[model samples]
Target: MQATLMIYNGTAAPDADVLRTGGVPLAPARTTWPMCGNTCGGPMQFFAHLPVDYGVLSVFVCQNDPGACDTHDPVSGANRVLLFPSAELVPVAVPEEGVTLLPAVSAITTAVVTLEPEEADEDGLPPDAYDLARGGWKWEPGELFGKQREVLGSLGGSPSCLGDDRLPECPSCSGVMEFAAHLEEGIDRRSAMNLGGDLGYVFVCRPCSQGAFLRD
Candidate 1:
């Protein structure tokens, strides 16, 4: 939610310290996720289309970007929001001889995502793997419906593995997960179109043999 802004004056190797995976890896090579929106977390890469430039030439913070908020629900399979920077002045590379620099813009700030939760995740990808499969769906003898009802009842019809957040995790265990498979179109609320064919990653915890899914 909160982030540190960086108005780089020159070219720098995308903060190698940051991450570069997940999502559709846009083009122009300018959008490189350097870090989280708050602290040292995951890298959220996306050129925010904020109405104004906040003088944030670059940024390093939590993966949560304020200007580029695209609420995408992998489970609901909806759309992703597109947030941008709030900078007023646009900076460009003017190579004079062999050097270049960025013109000062505005000021940038960071804070917890006070913005109301968007309808969907920003990447347009499912928040988690199970998101592809609604909560409490069960398997049964020619009647997966009953089993599903039971599962839903067990989950208290929560329709979510992770609290109210919609972020999914391995209830059976805890740890990072590995992408198992993807169920794009055919799957009902299985995954977002952005990640349907390229759904979330599945993980089988080493400890409990439990599984978790990350839609990213």
Candidate 2:
């Protein structure tokens, strides 16, 4: 999972706690990591601490060859890792470690860059290296939805949460609908496994069968 949760300046912004009327939370504005220069062989540059596991905004420099100085290679510098907010200052060897740990979430004024959503699967990298947390939430994106496998969760077991954010409304009747129930199996996106217990909600309107999938 990639580190999608970002820590932007949360001082007075509504990001503090402004919930949408329907109960879905608005995406927060956050300051992502920036591309600070590289460390000199003699003197190293230190990044501040971070809040949680975070991905690199951009990949520059060659971790494989510290002296390569070319920011466009697939060497160690071609990749990055999540940084804990309380790590001590450590010198990073690009080929050996593409990332260095910091003490706190990067300050509010850091620049925002984009990184490849997924890291190349490594032999021993932890699962979180590619898993991005959305506000402390661990959810697989909708990518792995078609694989068939075993079942689990309320996915198809009991009832569906009307909280899904994409339910459709009926144009014919003006009525409220909710996810009343779900199937008994769940479906994961990548594995094609029947992650059983996929919950299906029932939505029925007072005026008509305008009920449909609810918003998450």
Candidate 3:
């Protein structure tokens, strides 16, 4: 499988037009900051600003009460993925309370890589596209182990080890959402968007102008 890997490019300005994690989100006027309404009624942490083919994906997750908020469920109200128009967006107002933004803003760049499936198991199942791509990322030549921390995530790939039943449905159109991106925790622990040591998945319903977020 071929995937576009998101490589960490060090700290960046908060409002740049490249892929980045942790910064004030840019959204249309009147777009209110989302809250974690599932368990903790605090503001959701701004996660990333990802520019996809369709639009910019503005992500948020609950950090006020991570484990208790059910951030891993798409419809749990603990995490959110908003598809915003790339143009005419302004920085969103930051909430005064709770964990609203990551500690730092990290820039990202892309690299195209080809991933080959590992030998099939006894059941003859192929290796997951995401797993294969993530495990094979090599930042430098001859490096035995890829620097997982430097890998922010990938774009345009299927979910890693996610079951078919877990696919998110679009709240606006009630149709199955299309896979958008795979997000990793990030390069620095203190500034990273927490995902409970699992990979984060982003799904979108383009026609409905909606998106969903979950982790696995």
Candidate 4:
């Protein structure tokens, strides 16, 4: 399988036209900043700004209270995924309270990674292609364990280590959402979006202009 691996390219201008984690989010005019719907009831933390073929996928998760808000549940009102039009987006106004943005704006670059299946697949249980490719990504051939911190996750692939039964449905149309991207914590722990040591999944229903986010 082939996947587009995201590489960290150092700090970036908040609104730069690149894949990135952290910084202020860009949204259409009159779009209000999304607030967490759980007991915390504070502004959700901005996670990533992913530009895809269809549109830009903006992600947010509740960080005001972390696990207490159930950020891992798609419909728990803890995490949100927004698919916005490619044009006329403006940076959203920052809120004065709570954890609303990441501490650093990390830019991203991409590389196409190809992986060959392992022999274990013969038993009908195949390892995640994205995980395999990422785990083997080395800054230099001589390096052991690879530079995993530089990896920001993947674009345009099926969710890693996720099950079909957990795939979320679009709230508007009641249709299964398409897998959009996979997100890691970040290259820098100080500014990373907390995922409770799990991978984040993004799903979208382009026709309905809606999306869902969860972690596993």
Q: Which model scores highest in TM-score?
A: 4
> How far out, in Å, is residue 119 in model 3?
5.7
TM-score of 3: 0.93
What candidate 4 gets wrong by more than 4 Å, as runs, is 117-123, 139-143
Report every candidate's CA lDDT. Answer: 0.26, 0.25, 0.86, 0.88
Q: Give one digit per residue, the lDDT tens place, for model 4 in 11-130.
A: 889987678999888889888889888678899999999988888999999999777899888999988899998899899898999999898999999989887756556768767778
Could you arrange the candidates by lDDT from highest to lowest? 4, 3, 1, 2
> For every model shown, what is its TM-score relative to the native structure?
0.18, 0.19, 0.93, 0.94
lDDT of 1: 0.26
> Which candidate number has the best lDDT?
4
Candidate 1: where is the Cα deviation over 4 Å?
Answer: 1-24, 41-142, 145-216
Instruction: Please write out the lDDT profile of model 1 over residues 1-216, one tens digit for every residue.
Output: 111111212122222211111112222235433333233234443221112121121211122332242223322212212223333323322223310111112221221111223345686733432332332233346764532211111111112233335444444453333222221211223111223233232223334434333344
User: What TM-score should be assigned to candidate 4?
Assistant: 0.94
- What's every prediction's RMSD, in angstroms? 18.8, 23.1, 1.9, 1.6
lDDT of 2 by residue, 107-183 (tens): 13222222345543576533332122211232246654322222111111112223333343444553334323221
Ranking by TM-score: 4, 3, 2, 1
Alpha-carbon error at 213 in model 1, in Å?
Answer: 17
